[model samples]
Target: MQLTIERIYTKTVDHDGYRILVDRHWPRGISKVNAALDDWAKAIAPTTELRQWFNHIKDRFPEFQTRYLQELEQNPETPAFVTEVAKQLQTTNVILLYGAKDQEHNQAVVLLQYLQRQPAIQALLRKE
Candidate 1:
């Protein structure tokens, strides 16, 4: 599966495959029409409280990643999302779009890592 993470604010959109916005809140200054998204997987995003607590603080990134992974594990929508992504990967690339400025520390990064470790995704990767 070809999986990639991209900032929503980037001028160019990758139309090669499914573009999923993984943010709970709409990105500021961006309109829906311009997002070029196939799906907005808001259910997979961090809770409001967790987002607020993290606040993109670099110092808290380690803990934030731990908490975010825990949240994903407990989220009811995660299994479905993972299944959907795995299915999508069978045919095309999956672009995980996020609004975070920090490229390395956002929920999308965590989610991608989490998805990579899943058996379904791993099996899909082996086929390529």
Candidate 2:
């Protein structure tokens, strides 16, 4: 259950476990083959409308986080993704990969925080 967030473009891809892309859209200029990804959980990403509104504006990050969490709460795919990640954690580390340039303000960061706070996810991590 060692979860970490990483930029998709980073040179380090040596991690020996799940490397899931959590972005709604594929990163520009990166090919599927080059991504070295195990999964692309786009359903957990921010909606197109929300992404457009936030536009990575640093000033809007706080509000964006709140809004995104609300979206996640209602998103049916979130639970399934969390279950899947928890199951995977039984055996290996999990990387929630993202394409955002803002390391601290991306959806992956928020999603990671949300997941870490969940009791189910916490139990799984504790087992590891």
Candidate 3:
């Protein structure tokens, strides 16, 4: 099992799968109708405070990771939210779509790691 975040212009592979949008705000230029997204899982995205803090200074990635993890920890809804995505990943390739210019440091990267670490994701990987 694998998860990837791609820009709106990235080519879509021919596969049975789901593409989940991981951004809280609509991406600056992409229109909703043109996105062809399967679901918008905003719960996995960072809170507004976290986003603002990260965007405030690009030099604080490590700190952002810690704070984001903490924020996610207090959120009881994460497991179900992630599990919902995992269940879909099992049956199809999962693509996480994000709009951040700095794709490397955005919430999508954190979420990709978090989702991969899930026990369900581990089990699925072991089977492959």
Candidate 4:
């Protein structure tokens, strides 16, 4: 699967294929009409408590990644999300859209890595 990450607020508007927002809460100053999102996978986003604790602190990223991975594995929506993404990937490139300014430490980055490692996702990637 050709998965990529992009900040939601970027000025560039020419996103190709399916774009899914991976944020739990709607990002500030963005409207539904302009976001051009195909889906919002909020179920897999970090919990409110975790998000508040992390507070975008770069130092907390490591622990946050671990905790987030655990949450992804335990989350009921993960399997179905994987399946849906796999289905979509067969037809288009999947863009993981996020609102975080820190491209390196945000959930989208972690999620892209995590998705790359998933057996189901990996199997599809191998086909290419």
Candidate topping TM-score: 1
Q: What is the TM-score of each candidate against the true structure?
A: 0.97, 0.94, 0.87, 0.95
Give the distance in Å from residue 43's predicted Cα in candidate 3 to where it truly belongs.
Answer: 2.2
Candidate scoring better on lDDT of 1 and 4: 1
lDDT at 43 for candidate 2? 87
Q: Report the lDDT tens digits of candidate 3 across residue range 1-128.
A: 65666755555632446888888888776777778888887877889988987893668888888888887778887888778777877777788888877768777777788877888877775676
Question: How many backbone clashes does every candidate have?
Answer: 0, 0, 0, 0
lDDT of 1: 0.94
For candidate 1, write residues 45-73 as lDDT tens digits.
Answer: 99999999999999999999999999999
lDDT by residue for model 2 (1-91), tens: 5877889998867467898999999999888888888999998999999999999999999999999999999999988998988888888
Residue 120's C-alpha lDDT in candidate 1?
A: 95
Segments of candidate 4 deviating more than 4 angstroms: none
Which lDDT tens digits does candidate 4 get at residues 66-90? 9999999999999999888889889
Q: Which pairs clash in model 3?
A: none
Candidate 1 versus the native: TM-score? 0.97
TM-score of candidate 3 on Cα atoms, chains taken together: 0.87
Model-by-model lDDT, in order?
Answer: 0.94, 0.90, 0.77, 0.91
